[model samples]
Target: MEVLSHFVRVSISEYFRNLPVPDSFVGFARLTGTEWLTLLPFVGTVSLLIYVTIQAFKAKPVPEDTKVNRKIQKESSKVVNMVDIEDLGDKVSYCRCWRSKKFPLCDGSHTKHNEETGDNVGPLVLKRKGAA
Candidate 1:
């Protein structure tokens, strides 16, 4: 039957022409029972999640200036005091008459050449005691 398939169409002028739209909250309540039920829980949950994310972005990071390990690493690098002979001359010059089989790099023969009582350690020995 043609009447069974036909839908009842309401005109926009007659159905909504007299409604107070902009000044009333009832205009926003145009949802069906099923649509309202489905979105009710999700609306509040999403609002709270957005609020938490905004708060996290506004937080400041903690400043740390007294980092001991970083300071020690920086200072220890300057204290090694090793030199290259290729730019100068024989490696024996750095150790000051101390012999090293490794040539350019000192093998700590200066530690044994001079008395241990003094602070006269070769470059290689100083590096072994934690160099940069």
Candidate 2:
């Protein structure tokens, strides 16, 4: 067992000593301008990846309800409008502010509401699939 271990150690040392060392493996201080330029993109890519990973980990997740309810007001009126999908156009902007003279449809009345209450309320636009 002692003879085998010594032989293995000697073989490993010989193999490592015979391996060729790359010229670029020299210290960073010895790197030439061209070598620095060649390494720039790799360094930049690695830095960008690290930055993005950190940002992703640090980011706070936003709630879906908050996104859906943004700038929407709660009204006492629980009126629901029934409209035929076929009757609607390819693109439709429905009233969300409930201030529309054309109830259930947008007539750009939210602009006045926004101006009066300093609220940024807008229409809920619906679009049909395959309708550019």
Candidate 3:
């Protein structure tokens, strides 16, 4: 994107003055009509990208969520139980403890959750025989 943007800013369109472009860096010439037509796809892709980028910068941001919007979002959010942890057996009477500060089994609370998306609960089962 940066390279293409730079090319556009530099106005490289004049390079197409004739089909047999004499750009020093690349010696591409004597290309057939099909070869030239193949370039159109790349040109169209780059043009669309540039156009969309310009539009993105020019377009104003949408209005902030109003109280009503917030309420709706909150209500809709209640249905998300994406991290529902299943039963991890008993907590006590087993005579085992979690290595993590979270204690008990684990929600991976002790593990670094830099990229983990779910609840930081671990899969480690606390090996205990008594109440946790």
TM-score of each: 0.22, 0.40, 0.24
In TM-score terms, candidate 3 sits at 0.24
Candidate 3, residue 16: lDDT: 50
User: Each candidate's lDDT (Cα)?
Assistant: 0.49, 0.75, 0.48
The best-first sequence of candidates by lDDT reads 2, 1, 3
TM-score order, best first, reads 2, 3, 1
lDDT string for model 3 (16-116, tens) is: 54335335635556566776785676678889999999998896877673122222234554522232234445541211213333333244433453244
lDDT of 1 by residue, 1-132 (tens): 555434334443443443333346674587566655655555668799999999989867665733323322354544244555355432233333234455434666667645743545555322222324
Report per-prediction Cα RMSD to one decimal.
Answer: 17.2, 14.4, 14.7
Residue-level lDDT of model 2, residues 1-132, one tens digit each, is 989898789975775564443367456777668767766766788799999999988969885644322333346334667899898989999998777778678999899878977889899999999987
Best by TM-score: 2
Error of 1 at 100 (Å): 61
